[model samples]
Target: MIKKLSKKLSVSLSKSLDGNNEDVEIWTYGLELLLNGTIKFGLIAGLSAILGTFKPTFLILITFAAFRCFGGGVHFSTYPRCLTFGVIKFLILGSISNVKGNMFNYNLLFYVTLFLGILTIIKWVPGDTEIKPIKNKEDRKKQKVKTTIVLILWIIIVQILIRLNSFKYILPITLGALTSFIFITPLGYWFITSIDNILDKTKVKYGEVK
Candidate 1:
């Protein structure tokens, strides 16, 4: 549905603007990206409404954005797979964020998460994929350094939050850090590869690729 909508939008724009085929194709691709992103965000928002987890989910989104901005990660090959992975990821992070007071030590979790997250970033950071490789050495260096700084800043902020007894925020922040770290590892790249394989098999049986 999102793909069809995007295509229709691009076609409408092209006709109205008297665009050529190349221009229309570019517009179609951009519209697909816009629509796909909106649909995925909508899915998360709907889930939050049903689960009453808006705050935690929002925190998870913020933390995910912080590290992902510089750390980078695998991107799904197709929109459907991307949406599927995103929904699952946010669901788990949201669940973690909703854990009640004193069930587990939030402070301890924060410390552990910070350690692991920084270690992962330092060890295999600037992780790239076959389709979206980070090839420049200078670019790689900058990303790694920036990703490390983000993680460190996150730790400091979490510490301040803990001092303020903002226990509710700890879980989501820790989960976000962990998720971000995972993305900068080979595990994250393999996930995309796995998704690609699934898409390929389904396409083979259906005799078409979306």
Candidate 2:
């Protein structure tokens, strides 16, 4: 049953990537992202479940997805890249927890992991070796401020969610976060990239390549 579902999902996603129908493509893209994210989070949740820390698993997944929606989406613009990062991050978190002998304090480890991940993202910023002028200085400043505000809001919400033991609402929260992150970040990138490739091929076939 799972395999059948996965096959159908793949076909649907491929059709969406074709980008012939805008509305249907957008909806399909959203579903693709959600499914991919859910699978990734499910893997982490399974690992946590094995270690008897299921609640934190769901919480961590939500927090990670929220952050990805805001930041990592622009940094790693590929579904495979995002999945790779997710797997690496989970391994690092698990290894550090093992070394510290504190599985219950996974939240602390998650924060540390996120901090390091942010630093990594910054290090990979485009044009790091070259200086570029802001095309619209005022607009750039406003965007920076907005991004900061959104980040602060996200942090506060995460804190409240943790305190309220929202992790206990595991399945739904996981699904929501997973769905949002997938569309807004990795899977969205994949959809765009696939369309670009198809367009490039079509242009070439018509002798319109530049």
Candidate 3:
């Protein structure tokens, strides 16, 4: 469906804008991204309404999506799994925040996890997928810089939300930050690879997948 829409848009752009194949390809790719984002966000919003965890879900989506976009960590190879994983992810975070409410673990576990996240970012970032692999030194450096800036900004935002000292903000924002941090780690990379492998098996069983 998305491909067809992109194709139609590309054809229209070609006629209206008098564009070439490269221009058409650019517009088609842009349309695919726009469509995919719309669907994903729509699903997220629908789930938020059903779960009654709007704020938390929104925060989780924002932080997680931001990291996943620039951090360039693990991503599901297929579109279906990506959507599934994203929904499951925000739902879990939102559910936990709703149930647990304002919680404090001002202990070593919190500090340890935060430190681990920092280490992971320093070591594994800016992570890229196999398809959108960052091959150029300049591009790689730029991505890394952006990743660092975003992570720092996220940390600052989380701290500010934490200071709010409200379950509504603190719990959701803190947990969302934690989840985002973990997703950029080697473990996240492992999980992505595992999912891809399982999808590979599924495709084989189905035979000649679309």
Candidate 4:
């Protein structure tokens, strides 16, 4: 539905503006990405609010953006699957963080997460896909540096929060950071690709049945 809508809108706009086939294609792709992101984020926010986990969910998303902005990650084959998977993943993070408060050592978790995150960024920061490869060596270097800086800043901020007795925020922030860094690791790539393949096979089987 989103793909069809994007194509229709792009074609209509192209017709109105005398755009060529190439322009329409470009517009369609861009619009599809924009629409998918907007809808996915909206659904996540709405569901989090309804589930009474909005604060933790919002923090997780914010932390995700902070790290992911500098560290590129894997992409799914389809918009619907991406949206579905992301919504469920973040919701789980939020719910777990909310319910697991003070049950374990948050300080230990924070240190472990920070350590793993730094090592992952050092090894695979600016991870790229076939569709968006970072071929430039300088660009890759810059991304790694920026990601490291962000991780450092996160460490400082989390420490401050801890000193202030804001323990409730610790787990969500750590989870978010951990999730973002995972996307750049070998295991992360394999995991996401396996999911995409499974979903694709399922769709094919359903179509055959129909």
Write the residue-wise lDDT of candidate 4 on 1-210 in tens digits: 888999999999999999999999999999998998899889999999999999999999999989888898887876667778899999999999886556358877887888888888878889899888998999999999999998999999888888898888888888899899888888899999998887778879876310
RMSD (CA, Å), candidate 1 to true, equals: 3.3
Report the C-alpha lDDT of model 1 over 1-210, residue by residue, as the tens digit. Answer: 777887788889989999988988889888887787778888898897688887888788888878888888878777777788888889777976777867357767776777878677767777676756888989988998998888878878887887898888888877887887777778877877787887799899987764
User: What are the runs in model 1 whose C-alpha is more than 4 Å off?
Assistant: 1-31, 101-104, 202-210
**After superposing candidate 2, which stretches have Cα over 4 Å from the reference?**
1-20, 73-81, 94-143, 150-210
Tell me the deviation in Å of residue 145 in model 3.
2.2
- Predicted structure with the largest lDDT when compared to the true one: 4
lDDT of 2: 0.49
Model 4 RMSD, rounded to 1 decimal: 2.6
Supply the TM-score for candidate 3.
Answer: 0.87
- Candidate 2, residues 1-210, lDDT tens digits: the string is 333455566567667676345645455556666777787777777776787655544554555555443333333434555566565565444433333323255466336544544343343211111122334545444534543454456556656766786543332333333333333344445764565566568778886532
Could you give the C-alpha RMSD of every candidate to the true structure, in order shown?
A: 3.3, 11.5, 2.4, 2.6
Candidate 1 vs. true structure, TM-score: 0.80
Which residue pairs show backbone clashes in model 4? none
The number of clashing residue pairs in each candidate reads 0, 0, 1, 0
TM-score for each candidate, following the candidate numbering: 0.80, 0.43, 0.87, 0.87
Measure candidate 2: CA RMSD.
Answer: 11.5
